[model samples]
Target: MSEKIIFAGTPDFAAEHLKALIEAKYNIIAVYTQPDRPSGRGHKLTPSPVKSLALEHNIPVFTPVNFKEEADKAQFESLQADLAVVVAYGLILPERILNAPRLGCINVHGSLLPQWRGAAPIQRALLSGQDKTGVTIMQIVKELDAGDMLYKKEIEITTQDTSGTLFERLASCGAQALVEAMPKILAQELVPQKQDSALVTYAQKLSKDESPLNFNHSAKQLSLQVRGLNPWPVATTTFDEVVYKVFLAQELSAEQVALLGKIDDLENGAIVQVSSEGITVKCAEGCLLLQTIQAPGKGRVSAGDFARSKKDLFVRGKCFA
Candidate 1:
């Protein structure tokens, strides 16, 4: 017999796993997602991605603020689900809810265990320039993401990957990983391994303050920052007293670095050169070629195009603070 599952999650990441489970013919008795919140410019109440998917599948949905209320716990207990699958679920499940399922709750976390064990793992991995990251299937505990691992699958972190791209990839990866692990889980053939507490590193949530590009960092670091922040709180820098958002950037080549070295008194964050390829800027360690950028109230365009239209503003020696 197939295991009965109670699904809990909120965002697109969570919805992807639910879709995978549904496609695999898992018995999802009900779904628990965060309450609908005001979204977009109009501030209209919007359902979470998981809720929308659950509704489409005609699965029962619950949006409890928390399980602190005895009624909420009672309602969950009444389901008597054999298992619970959680992915990017916003709310913390109390111990009662965690133990309610016969097989307990398992989480599809977007990072390798013992590292990036908190929220925003995808963005954190990109910002840290990790060569790779992956999904971890683990038994959920009371502590935040401090779970016993059942399975993990790694994927390379390409230089060109932005947080938005990585997010999509990991979401799909997590779905596949969960689907593969579920059979072993149901058959009682999988053993949960304890994570080393010494290797734990938390991924603090992203903040608006981290959006500004700091030229003091190396070009490689700045490039990673720009990529990691894309699609949300995008990296920005002030050039000629105007804030411009950076979308795509790359570290300069050895030839370009030598060319920049020839320029006397080159200061970090100063415009180095502008060509058909892109706009190059000096950095603390090397140089960065800005491929894509967006000025306030303007659509994103190639740095070369921006330079062509605003040549005076991008002249060599102007610094981006």
Candidate 2:
């Protein structure tokens, strides 16, 4: 109950775990998060979710630029922590800092280990159309997410789950897994299992280039892409040199697919009507019904509003090009 714990995290997902540890009566001595960075349209500096939560709980917060630095490692060792709990901390740990804690470091990873073992795991999983994904608590190692598994909890990836939606669910489940495993970990009853190198896969961080809508892909793939990239670097299409963000979409049915006679005829990114849904022109595939969209310099609005604003732009057979 009184094991001095050092918590390292940066995002809301990590903050949730920190909250759980505190609530579960663990001794969280200090919290470490990434440094504040410029955000929003105004580019004002914003504190990370973990840092904000730590401040609220009156926990000492540390934002070392790099843990590999000697000074940072020294400062971390000074904590004299029995265990270091890390969740999406966004910083790599060196051997020195890893050994500083008496019980070693443990991480709450967002995906099943040996798969999706890097940043943007939740998004990558959804974008890849995986049927399910889950959390894994592991002992941190120098290798990237190559740590040994301590405990894991699985969750289904539904057809409608987005990165934002899945993130909140896993955050809660991950927090519970971490809290439940802490005692077992401290008592040395939980043994860490080495991940299989053969099955190792990386969930590379999302990039702006991945945001643009590619019509050449299938309707289902496009739908998954839209969900995975929602709310950031949103799946977008260019129409009249203006970018239209696709926030929500769905795959076309066979009947609707039949209506899209020739892809080239439909205006690329142009609005289309199929089976009572508003779809967008894609190069080689059936229309993708866009449920929500945001135009450049404007707030998010329904696809209907966007369609109405450019009524002529959305007629059937008009190609986006």
Candidate 3:
């Protein structure tokens, strides 16, 4: 018989693992996800991706705000699940709920444990210019993401990878890793390994304050920031009292750097040049080629196209704060 599993998670990342379990016929008895929240321009209540998938498969779902309540704890224990799998579950599971399942709880974390041990691991990895990251399946403990690891799989982080793209790749990777580890988990053949305390790194959640572009940073760092925050809280700068969001950027070439040096009295954030290649902006250490940008109330457009239509706005010497 298949193992009786209790699944808990939210967001698209979590939903992917739940979907994989269903396809694998793991006998999911119930799913726990965050409560529906108002979303989009209309502010309509929208169910989480996990909840939507659970209902489609006719699986029972719970959205308890927390397990602190005695009733909620009792109901969870009543499930009598052999194992519990968590992936990006927003809520913290108290000790009572954590020990409810016979095999205890296992988490499918986005980053290799002890590296990025908190929220927003994928974005953190890209923002820090990490060349690679991976997923880890671990036994959840009291501390956050401090669980002992059972399995792991690594993947490369390409220069072109944004948080959105990396998220999709890691989600799929986590699903496959979890599925492959299931047989060993069922037989208790896998030995969990303790993480090194000295190697622990935290990925605090992203905030609006992190979205603004600071030209004082090197061109390479700024480029990573732009890509890391893409599709959410995008990197922005002030131009003529309006916010200009930067979606894509790259470091300028040596030739471009030489051209920038020729321009006198140019400050960081100043528009150095605009051409078919892109819009070059001066930075503290180097120049950045802005590939895609968006003005307030406007859709994203190529820097070249935007420069053509708004020549007066992007003229050389005009500065962005």
Question: What are the TM-scores, per candidate, against the unseen true structure?
Answer: 0.97, 0.90, 0.95
Per residue, candidate 2 scores C-alpha lDDT tens digits across 174-210 of 9989888888999999877989999988999899899
Estimate candidate 2's RMSD in Å: 2.6
lDDT of each: 0.91, 0.84, 0.91
Q: Report model 1's TM-score to 2 decimal places.
A: 0.97
TM-score of model number 2 = 0.90
Best by TM-score: 1
Ranking by lDDT: 1, 3, 2
Off by over 4 Å in 1: 259-261
Clashing pairs in 3: none
lDDT of 1 at 274: 91
**Residue 164's lDDT in candidate 3:** 91
Model 3 C-alpha lDDT per residue in residues 73-101, reported as the tens digit of each score:
99989999999999999899998888989
Q: Cα deviation of 124 in candidate 2 (Å)?
A: 0.9
Task: Give the poorly placed runs of model 3, Cα more than 4 Å off.
Answer: 255-265
Give one digit per residue, the lDDT tens place, for model 1 in 1-321.
Answer: 467899999999999999999999999999999999999999999999999999999999999998899999999999999999999888989899999999999999999988998878999999999999999999999999998999999999998899999999999999999999999997878988999999999999998899898877889999999999998889998888889999999998778789765755877888888987788888888888889999899899999888978898789888889
